[model samples]
Target: MTHATAPSPDAPLEASATIDGAEWWRSAVIYQIYPRSFADANGDGMGDLAGITSRLDALKQLGIDAIWLSPFFASPQKDAGYDVSDYCAVDPLFGTLEDFDTMADAAHARGIRVIVDLVPNNSSDQHEWFQEALAAAPGSPERARYIFRDGRGEHGEEAPNNWDSVFGGPAWTRTANADGSPDQWYLHLFDSSQPDFDWSNADVRRMFRDVLRFWLDRGVDGFRVDVAHGLVKADGLPDFTPPVGAGSMGGQAADEEPVTAPYWGQEGVHEIYREWNQVLAEYDGQRVLCAEAWVDPLEKMALWVRSDEMQQAFNFPYLETPWNGPALRTIIDKSLAAFSSVGAPSTWVLSNHDVVRHASRLALTAENPQGHGIGPETGDRPDRELGLRRARAASALMLALPGGAYIYQGEELGLPEAIDLPDEARQDPTWFRTSGERYGRDGCRVPIPWEADAPAYGFSETGASWLPQPEDWGPYARASQRGDADSTLELYSRALWLRSTHQLGLGAIEWHDAGDDSILWFSNGPITVVANTGVTDAVVPTPLRDATRILASSPHDEGALPADTTAWFLTP
Candidate 1:
């Protein structure tokens, strides 16, 4: 856990250096690909590995540095591949092991590094281990791999604890024995179909260790550790009492202490990552481990990325921050400072497969803005134009910051949540677990648009997308945006290009004096990024008002930055 003290923002980062030509991820612009919705090659109405391999060229052309792939491991698809049935094999729903190898080779050929999801916290109910655990007598070794315990009530009738599932309902589910009697209760922080592992067990630790080596040896570049902070529960399966009310994304309310959460950010989790760091160091590619921790107080989140643990952790607070100037600045400054405490680089993310797409969520000026668990209103349509404008601006501002960034699959196309899907078509476990009161994240999981008019919007050759695509998506299709200068896709491409060729991601960002609450202006070296989230047009501030205009989220003509616009400039 030892490293040199963090250098000042102006100094080059030691972690950003090349180790046998593997310094790409330090300031890399990584893209997240949700397999089932990215594209479908065999026309099974779902995206697969072969389809992903075929589209590597498009991603390469997108000017990104790497790809962070969600799970495609063997599974029952109960959690869409997160509930892994077999850690070493590919799920047929996606493709075979050969398909994964081909996809890896193709991605490398295009200079794009591959980082797959690692779900060490849980396994599908259908997995051989879980199946054996289900059939074995209580207190057997098979049951030890999972977190199985006898129920607490008389006659073992009730669940072991009162903890709630992240999806919904009780966290513990009872298992029946051959005698038709309730045997034991197993813990699943998410769905009952995905049983949580007992990290304290030696076997569980060894199994995940082997799984990590299996992927690392497969020529993949890294892993995005799913539920990275939830590996080890508190000493006892304690009742999680939030200081105030309940919450998700680490399940802490605004005023709740982050590190004290019962099921997350435990001290034991670091030992797991410290060992994982050794395994990553053995590989040649500077194979990284990125945590999907949602812990807050930024300093607590920093624990996961200390020199010996994970290389990076997602900056969820930044992703969830509102599009206000002072609010965003506070989160940004705190995030940078926190990560610096550990001598690690902070990773910025906008939207991912698990949340509502930022394009639409940022446009919500009404109730429940995070778009978590809320379905679309019966007769309301989100402000598509407004959301896209802000998303574009946010993208520029994110890329201009000093660290790595992640782009969800369709962010570049200005895609919003597919809110109009019929209730019957929804598939998130949270929806069913909550009895339809919670919509879950299916809205953000819709298949992406590639061709403007092709069948299923070019998601599948058979014109069948696993999740329905909206009709309005045609205008934002890749075909329509590829050469269009004003398209969000191209705007992202240009921003990434500037980011890659310059020292923007490695340098400090100093605040620019715009003197307006609605606008955020910041300078990185000689380049400046100004974002106006207000409702009125804004004049660029100060002596550089007439500086050379470069890239913009929306068009800037005659020296005026329109509302919800972001523009890049050269500080003359």
Candidate 2:
């Protein structure tokens, strides 16, 4: 609760000597709670700030050092709170600003820090800034808050830039004049409702810094800057070249028109992040700034966390990599190398509000219909037990890594994807725009099941949830797993305890690729972790000979990891 006095601009900023301290995030476990779906305390079928505040003890019991709440800022919900209408106000649906203050005070009182998501690139059309920009009054300051242009003729028929929106479609949207003629074009890196701000403008930068200060003043710990890399773009808006093959580098098929090259990761982004970090450094301990950057190149990712920039940038490569042992090992090794090269602390995220759940991704295939079996020939079906084992395994591996680890809500419960949404029930904008090529994130966004027979699985009491709760999720609810000694919840608790009590997953990481598809091996000081991504059993070779049994496979055997199991050990 102690606030560091603001340092004078003439004084040197004291960079954190080490990631260790009251900045619990350094060696902490962050549980990401999508406020809308975490718990609906009002019984209105929507999760609110009060609901989250009520769950503080549960989170504390889970042993998470902090809770990264997805945006609850005032918005039209066009992008599910990502498009802010007012950075200083809380949305009515979530609760009032006073409610947020109550939540923050409660969380801090319980030794839990609260971090909220801040999407700087855009705001709702309802935002005062966007409204003023649209009006474009003479010499108005609001006009400078966003990127506004005269017309497409000044650039071209298409967007001045070849950048594609992350939500599918053009990054530029055409606006018409009062007379109905083409008047201007605005840049939107995600949705048209979320316009990109002109970071080049000093006023825009200052305004955003004030926004940050506003939240910090409200007693919130920090922010997770959404789409942090897309803040800046190629000024020229040059044409982009597509990859040679049909799919993206992440192994997903490309749907848009072929281009010569992508337009992300421009050099100007570094200065923008540096300035943000400088402003954030003015806060006290645990006042962190983390970036949600999706850039693949290690150098680009490093730019967001290069000491003078962000405290942490998400390591997304690990999220998309195949769950095979060798693939995971390569990712961990490469990530450590990259973070070390940049002299910044690393961060690992298994899942978030934006992506598919890890359990559903690793389990629930065509051959393995019920996700609980263990066999090389189980093929591809929903293997519940296997999924649970793998969930534990992924947690163990993540905790054993050298950096901070993020856990999406319900991941610890080994929750699977909701498979029964009718077409009309789908609400994800991505699925609507992409013609269902991608399954909507509704599966992961569904209501959190809290009990076996409680109405709507304890998410709400009166109405049905915005998204249907998965049938039979009762077994995975918190009430069901809380007392079970061998449940996935217990495993996660043990993993977190190990990380905090022994610092096994803290400090530096050294990785060794065992050159096998079935196993991923890495060491942090004396602690080592190995995960089996394949269905077949993998043997730990002599290179791992120094390992002593610290934690082993649970509800399954050691040598054979049952598709997605993980194990850990310590060396003398």
Predictions in order: lDDT: 0.83, 0.71
Candidate 2: lDDT of 181? 62
lDDT of 1 by residue, 60-86 (tens): 777787899899998888888889999
What are the models' TM-scores? 0.94, 0.86
TM-score for candidate 2, please give it.
0.86
lDDT value, residue 325 of candidate 2: 69
What stretches of model 1 exceed 4 Å from their correct place?
1-22, 243-246, 255-259, 367-374, 378-381
Q: Show where candidate 2 strays beyond 4 Å.
A: 1-23, 137-142, 150-163, 244-263, 364-386, 510-517, 539-550, 557-563
Question: Can you write out model 2's per-residue Cα lDDT over 23-93, one digit (the tens) per residue?
Answer: 45556678898999988878888899998988888777777888999999999998789889999899988
